[model samples]
Target chain A: MDLHLSERHLRFRDELRAWLEKNVVRPWREELRDPTASEDSLIELRRAWQKKLHAGGYLGLDWPKEWGGRGATAVEKSIFEAELVRADAPPILNFLGLSLLGPALIHHGSEEQRRRFIPPMLSADEIWCQGFSEPGAGSDLASLKTAARLEGDEFVVNGQKVWTTYGPWADWIFVLARTDAKNRYGGISFILVELRTPGVTVRPLRQITGESEFGEVFFEDARVPRANLVGQIGEGWKIAMTVLAYERGATALAYSTRYSRDLAALAHACREVGRTGPAVREKLARLVVENEVMRANGVRMLANLADGKIPGPEASMEKLFWSEFDKRFRDTAIDLLGPGGLLLRSCSEARPEVDWAREFLWSRAETIFSGSSEVQRNILAKRALSLPQEG
Target chain B: MRFELSDDQRLLRDSARDFLAAEFPLEETQRVVEHDPRGFDPAAWARLGEMGYLGLTLPAEVGGQQLGAVELAIVLEEMGRACVPGPYLDVALAAALLAAAGGRERLLAEIASGKAIVTIARQDAAFAGEAPCGIETANGKLRGRKYFVPFAAEAQALLVTTPGGVYRTDAPFAVTPLPTLDPTQRFARVDFDHVAERMAAADVVAGLEPLAAAAAAAMLLGVMSRAFEITLDYVKTRQAFGRPIGSFQALQHRLADALLRVESTRSAVYRAAWCLDNADPDAALAAASAKAYAGDAARLVCGESIQMHGGIGFTWELGLHFFLKRAKTLESHYGSTEVQLERALAAAGL
Candidate 1:
């Protein structure tokens, strides 16, 4: 089987690589290492990066061209991401909007909603946070208690959404709120609520990494226009499930690229410290092997996507692999580098190439946030294997 | 880009699977492993050669099909799934080495047509920390011992490795069988003190290492996959606590993790095979990574398969131990996991 990129996709990748090399003035690690960079300033830098990518016509790649997409395929999209990682470019600021909400709206929203939301979302003028997980319902997302009752011209919302990524900085939240309290899955409605709505509140939640990259959103009778509903009522669960699957296509390529960079940095760091013992070397080598295997898996996925195959529920296998490998890689990095590896990026003695301590802590969230490892395993068992569900 | 077998490769795989299931089923393999001195049926090997499997990766000019490594991996993977017993991989690798050396046309044709059996003997000792390849050739005579030579008793000749070159020495040399954990394997320590023709320089078979590792890893991919399927079937039917044990979340999650390992190994094995066939720049590193990862993944999947099967899993009658033993043997040989890790590290320049 051919794994080589087609000439057309190769051209797309080469052009994107050249563009990234020319445009990325400061790599993301350098930005992170900047002692003076605050959270807000970093976000603004990300917003500017998104604007640059949008202008380069690299955003919404794989979406229909009518909505500012590049009319590219998944192969191009995967290459774009891999190039972004290889160049160490800042992540696009509005990923939630671009990856999750944009797909949801494009597929299920009213034409009026798309007209109002799609442009600003692409331009980073309006950032969106997913309002799926809540304090009471996470792995069991359909159990969400968020309620939105339709009034004359608005839906009055009341619920607290926790682990709302980008909640602290986003202008909007696309929520899965219950419209029919009695039906578990069908009763839910997908509603987009403005943070500026009268009773909405956003409070940053301090993560173990000591950053509020995500936060909790409170909806105390927040009045969102009824016109903002994405699709017919009671169709939110179906839309959310479909949107989550969109996030899975060829992501392993991006993860492998990012991890390979860090792994190389870690290896260099080990050499600098003269930790040449066999034990440390073996650990480093194992990480290298695992990372390369991950890359193989990613390449396989990319090729399958290019072959026009839709990934099935076994996509959870990819999620399980990369997320679990992140934990192992980070843990080994810390163990190999010793105490110095635990220093925060801002610390004077910390390694400049990577914030090892922050990464070690952040990797904990990788498996937890995008469907916890346990949840993914359950999905594989029930869907991919067709094993009998718990009695 | 497609990450699947081509139509021809799929046909080869289907034929190999069908052939193995019919000719060398597990029951037959059990008998061979139990009573045969050679550890494999000679008749079955002849059939494999007749099927053009013995020369799968050799050149068409040498009486081979001129298939690529991916196709070889497909056949070996099916061989692994069937738990087919033989020195099939050993003989193919030996023939490849001979073909690479460039002076053995008649012997290569004999190998491709099932008229000869030969395997490379390189290891100087059975355990680690020993100096590799104590064997040396002086003039036309080869001397010294090689450990863990597969099917040395049955091999028509041995491609003996020296510090200076590789020599193809005829059999009737000293050979002692060294039975290990896997009864289906035929390994021996061969003492060489015979007049031997130095076929190629020491580095002539260097490229074969990656091919050997990747092929072994392909077989491991097959072994572990079959084990996973067997375990999945067992969990579905075997009841405990008034319900099917597969319904248990504890078992299901572990099975899910096993599936992840198995699928990841598939990706790594085929990618390595593809890289080698195309002579890609990443070929060495990919093959090493595939071997290292597949070894560990196979051990996990096979062990967990036995664990989930409970009592019957440990029984010899159930035949699960064959897979578990095969996995261990595969892991410890063909550039053992530790050696492959180092190779991967060196290839990556880490």
Candidate 2:
């Protein structure tokens, strides 16, 4: 069982590392700690970074080469993520478009749709937000009440999508709206609606972290062209399921890298504060052990991917692990850091290494979003374990 | 980069599993635990040596297969699944220490041929929170006591640890059995008064801790996984409230969490074994992490197996308690989770 990177993969990593070293002028932490940086300015910074990555031919890393990709394997994609974390580079502004919508359109969208959408999506000219979750249809996404009726040349849509991450700045929303009201799963249609359409509205919602990173989108009889529909009318659920599967890439490596950096920072902070007692040291050591295990898990996942193994229901285990561990790590950081840990990033007394307060609050949303911990557990029980369904 | 066992390793695992299943089923283990003074069947122990299981990691010069840690982990994991009764890990480690000291070829051959039994006697205390190194050398003879020496009553010789070095002490008298949660395990406190010959420096066995931790964690992985599987099967067939109890969301979610721990332990155990086999830079930290993680994971999975089984789980006749008890013993020994945590921290330079 070999875990060493192949020569080709090593070359890919070295080249990417060199590119990052040359291009990244300011690490993301420095940008976030800038007192004058506003939300819009930070987003512009990320957009600029995305453009740089696209120019470097690093975007859509594992996608087919015909669509501006490097035609890399999953191992390369995992290494790209880990390198980004190690460099502390700013996250791309159009991640939803690149990760979710790009795969969906490449696989299920009509040729015309791909031609119109893929380029701008890669270039960060048009940002995308998911319109799948709503106030009434979160864990039970198929129960969505969003309706879309076909008119002469357009589909009239009416829906309210909540927890719309990036909706505040996105130019488009790919929605799952009901076209046949009687059928639960098959009636759903995947439609892309412009944010500036006549009756569409986007209102930012303040999160517990005191940021408007996500918002709610309202659709009041918005007319989207029939050409915006992806695939057949009744195939939205199938397409959406496949799109979610794309999110299950080897993310553990990136998560562990980022966490390790923050953990080292926390350890330094503890030393600076002279909190090196046995109890505190034990807590820090446990976190260290846990993070190392997470790294092992990530390495195993990458090795399996390289071994030509398809990820199955075990992806839920990864999701549950990182998300839950985030909460524990953040909670321990706050406990060890004392009251100073709760200070906002703008506060002068706050730790500059990590936005501890923001992460502490943001970790709450991680378990709730994507797929909630409960949903992941259900997936493991029903799919992986093959347990009997509830009567 | 591949994470799976190679073809030869897979063959070893399959053969080990088949042999252990046939020769050391839970019923036979139960019989040994109940009546065998040696804590293992003599015939079965001889079979293991004949099958080359005893010398899995020893060099060919000593009549061994000269395999690596991954192969040892595979065999030990299967033994754990079968709840095989013996001092397999103890004897293998003792033999390795002797091999590393660069002498005693005859004893090594005897060990590989199942003609003799030897195990390390290292523990200096009978309980936690006590000062260590009570055992020392005096008058060219080993003195003081060593606690938790595996199979001390049955071992023909004991490699006793002293303040200065490790000494080979032949055994004839003075062994007090210290039985606890696991009946299949035979630990003892040995009053070492025999004339001793210093075998090697104290640090000669420095490399053994990680190997021991990784191998023990592999055994824990097997124990928890088998317990989980047994519980899963039980819930699928056992009825409650007019339907299978596994259908309830409460049981389902808990079982899901249990599965998470079991699988995570598997990943950690194999990764540690691989790192050690390859002599990778991360070997120490990976082995420590695997042991620490597996200790807690085995506790949860084995405890949940009993909880899910309701009443029969607690009964001795059902044999679930044996797994739970064995898991506890494995957790506290072979470098306990607390010790591994500290080792991991040092390895990571935290």
Candidate 3:
């Protein structure tokens, strides 16, 4: 029940903080602050920073040591994340691979698969995209229509995956397809396909932020090796659940920490600009509180995971809070910025826009992605509350 | 770091649930609502006291079980499920205030023995703008009005905070019972006109804020659980056009949304309670957030519970009104959702 971090954990936090201070260069910070930074520059800066993290043994702290990770404890991983955020490190393009697919592979992949995939993922030499969410199967994932048919030693896949973050640059994709359509959940199977497959195509969808960070990936007759299948055949739903847990739990921490830092920066920026209005102050204050609560909720969830307690329905609770809080904080930042918030960094007369406008637009997806708030609520009702499930 | 409840706490929760189900059912709640100063059965209070539930949060030295806030929240959820109306919230809050105020040996002892029903009047006219300070000392007397004092009509002693200090208003003070939205919980407007008082120098108001918010959050947790249950029952039984109403995606989505609110609110409330027991610095903000979130959730769930029930749910005879009244009343008590947001902002130094 105690919220204070242990002395050893505090020391670990200090060490990480010091390391980040030395190695985390400020180019990404400048890029994040300067909305004028070109998209290519931002992408390149993120990849280069991820390489620095790999060299520093901080990129995949929770992964096995054989996979080039530090093999750190949950506490250490949490500390690394907090420190990385406080240092304002660049976003990790390999997050989908390292946090989601890597863990899933470690638990469910073949030995050869692990040996081939883990190291490259840790080094950011390969970026991965998730293909669990199809155009039809969102919250009701068991109802997916994506088909993968076995043909000799390989499988031919055909489906459309929407909201594929960084799908355009991904070297590979981990997808779930219906291999046995009669069994519903049991009919599914997970497989990894190289993005360079002949029939694979990615079309980036422009976001409200004017950046196509996500894309709609279509697979038609995409051939993947049988060895790429994870776990047993027709066990894709089980594998997907494991990946979803890792994705939801890990990203909850990352997103909350990032938003907390963003809120702090916004507060400091407001103070520097001599924004004294009560509305501005009030909005800033609420964001601070929301950010703090989100942090605490993240800590509690991590604690549960560290203690070997399955996150269960409560993980969705954290997800719900994090997504909602992220939206609220970003919106509040935009409101506080007022007229200047609408101005882009390219506008010379703009009051140092600080990317708050871009961030606000991005935050709208918080509820839509990672299981819409509505879906999370349904999970909460049926699982956590033990309410009767409706047809 | 562990977020799961301890085995003892889980057992405590289960036993509390069983006790409420077997002893103080909704019928008892209805009876209390029909007759009683605080709109609760005194015999049921005695039964709970005998079960050692009254002093669940107090120290053992004061005839209590010395359980933590998590346990208190668990008990509160069960109480809310049964819709058991009483001065339980007021008593728990008073014990917390007395413990925080320090040097209240006699008062705590009396409270533990169930001989004294103590309540804190937080919403006083003078300290309405500040952190609920309401005790005053001038010519050896205390005079002020405490608004919306829960169970003031039945409370044996009142803990009043003022700018000068906190004071005990024992007797001879005017207590006027006010008609409230929730008949299950009674309220009164107390006017202290030069009442005899004992000054409590400790800043109990600040200490009591977190606990009060936690208790309110706990009550809302109960409200949500029952509302969720009622909604589920209605959706399962009530038929629409050749199907159950719950079969409709529109209603299912709304129910799911309501369920999300309830569960998240539960998490926030219990986490806040845990923090309060552990003395976390962020406890105040957490509690406020929980209160605001849970209060809103309870109101929404209760409103939807009635709506989802269709015509029967809207009737006064249907028992939905009991929960609806309590949920709506609790939304503004302790602190309004806006007040909590403001407190949270202030706590965050916004």
Tens digit per residue, CA lDDT, model 1, A1-391:
9989999999998899899989999999999888899999999999999999999998998788988897788778888888899999998999989999999989999888899999999999999998999999998988999999999999999999999888999999999999998999999999999999999999999999999988999999888889999889999999998987876775859988898889889999999999988899899889989888889989999999988887886578888988999999999999999999999888899988889999999999999988899999999999888898876
Give the local distance difference test score of model 2.
0.90
Say which candidate scores most in DockQ. Answer: 1
Stretches > 4 Å off in candidate 1: B131-133
> What does candidate 2's lDDT look like per residue over A319-357, in tens digits?
998999999999999999999999999999999899999
The candidate 3 chain B region of ten consecutive residues with least summed lDDT is B126-135
DockQ of candidate 3 is 0.31
What TM-score does chain A reach in every model? Answer: 0.98, 0.99, 0.92
The C-alpha lDDT values of all candidates are 0.90, 0.90, 0.76
Query: Candidate 3: misplaced stretches above 4 Å?
Result: A1-14, A34-37, A70-79, A131-163, A175-192, A196-203, A216-238, A268-296, A348-354, A377-391, B126-136
DockQ of all candidate complexes: 0.89, 0.83, 0.31
What lDDT does model 1 reach?
Answer: 0.90
lDDT per residue as tens, model 3, B32-70: 688655677666777788777788888788788988888
iRMS values for every prediction = 0.6, 0.9, 3.4
User: Model 2, which residues run further than 4 Å from truth?
Assistant: none
